[model samples]
Target: MFLPAVVLGALVLACLVSLGTGAADLGLADLFSGSDDSSRILLVSRVPRTLAAVLAGSGVAVAGSVMQMSMHNRFVSPTTAGTSQFALVGLLAVALLAPATSVMGKMLVASACAVAGSGLLLRLLHLLPARRTPADVTVPLIGLMLGGVVEAGTTFVAWRYDLLQSLGSWTAGDLSRVLAGRYELLWVVAALALALYLAADHLTVAGLGEDAATGLGLSYRLVVDLAVAAAVMTAVSVVVVGTLPFLGLVVPNAASRICGDNLRRALPVVAAGGALLTVVCDVVGRLVHYPYEISVTVIMGVVGAGAFIVIILRGVDRA
Candidate 1:
């Protein structure tokens, strides 16, 4: 009870701070003052940015949680599994081939590619000889290599097409550019979250193992596919905002530590924690340099990297 209240309060505070901290100063007075600049900034920039951060953070965190549960590996996530890189490849192709495509069309293409990439990773994991090596060690390594390969291909394509600069923005998760029309796709994360909640029990059961899920009369493959689809869509849709590194890993792991492995009970907490952490990071990015903002991607990279190291160390200790 107390934990939920604290997280909710922090989330609210983060939203408020995100709304006020930007190039243009805004306050409660400014919000209601009818000043054109303040109103425009609020409507066009701050609100959208806040929403994007919250939604992206929540979506990515939930996706990470689902990935860990279904894959039975904590390190595997959209970032580690090459989902973002694959999405970038699709985004680059669309940009080059169909430059006039709508944002939704681009996202659809990206989501498809992301799903493919994640599916390939899953296949690789399945093919790995569990008798030869532990999965916890193998899965993340495979994912990293896969992501590197996809990233290299994306870089090559972007370089060839002179779209490296554009690709750079997508690779770096930055909420600074979020605007009303541009950031609306992130709201799809909300629906995705709702769907995850609805299927939380099935997902949890699926995580127990195929035989166990089958014993429970649940289609293990179907539940995994649904979970993967939700995660891929959540990850790919947030490409407009930029890639959030380690967010899925760190947040879900943290949530699991605090709340345990019961997906039905833990999913909402993980989402809220993700949203809070992201908003706080965004706020820190704004205030760290003061006036000139550091991108949230940069901040999260440093922070997430540190957190990941800690998680690994803890895992080793447990082993």
Candidate 2:
């Protein structure tokens, strides 16, 4: 709770910094007066960008936390293991299936496809012989292979249709295009949050392994289905935002270190940490290049990859 409060405060401070400090700087007084063009820029451009960063960060982080807990794996996430890739496959299928559909329609198709793909992947896991090793290690490796296959398929389709550039756009996340009507789809984040919150207890119990959860009279399959649904919603959120890798893996782990592994208690803190980290990254990206903005994907990749390496090393040492 204390950590989350601090993250929330940091997020607030970052938002203010993003608003006031841009390529075209606007002073605090100038921002409040609302007369200057700078104020309008601040309101119209930076504010929306900041909000998008917050939404993307919070959504991905919380979703990742839930997913990691549900899977009982500290190393897995939508980004790390290719759930987002499959989600992109879903989005691409929608576009290919109906070339002229509305964005909402497209998102629906994508979400459904993502859910189906994820469900298939989960079921496929049942076929593999029980590993002597931890489920976490094997699950993500399988998911990575699955994601690679999906990506190859995506690439082939894009090449055939001459939509490679269009496909690439959704694969890499960018906030520059965020504005009034376009970003409302991000409200899926709110929906994901609500669903996960309601199911947190069930999810936690399910995380205790299937036999254990069944002993408690919980339907293991149903609980897992719900977790996958939550993950699918998360996949769609990241697909919409573009892929910001490591937000999920890092945020929940960091929160767990401070708050313990209780998903119900750790969720809000993880979400706040996710949002704060993203905003800080986005602001840093904008400032790093001055006139030209750096893609959040690039920035996160450099930072997230490093953090993940450290996590892996630490985990190995502890083992």
Best by lDDT: 1
State the TM-score for model 2: 0.92
Q: List the residue pairs that clash in candidate 1.
A: 173-242
* Candidate 2, 1-319: lDDT as tens digits: 5676788898899888877766775766666776769767875787777788888888888878777776667877776557788778877877787878877777777777667766766776778765423324677787778888888989999999988998888877787777655667777776777788788888888887888899999999888777665565666565567888888888877787778767788888887888888888887788898877888888888888898887776662111
What is candidate 2's CA lDDT for residue 305?
A: 86
TM per candidate comes to 0.94, 0.92
Q: For candidate 1, write residues 31-148 as lDDT tens digits.
A: 6688889889999999888888888898998988898887788887788878888889888989999999998888888888888888888889889764332136688889899999
Which runs in model 2 stand beyond 4 Å of their true positions?
A: 36-39, 129-136, 316-319
Q: Residue 301 lDDT in model 1?
A: 91
lDDT of all predictions: 0.83, 0.76
Return the top candidate by TM-score. Answer: 1
List candidate 1 stretches off by more than 4 Å.
32-36, 130-135, 316-319
User: For each predicted model, how many residue pairs clash, with residues at least 3 apart or on different chains?
Assistant: 1, 1
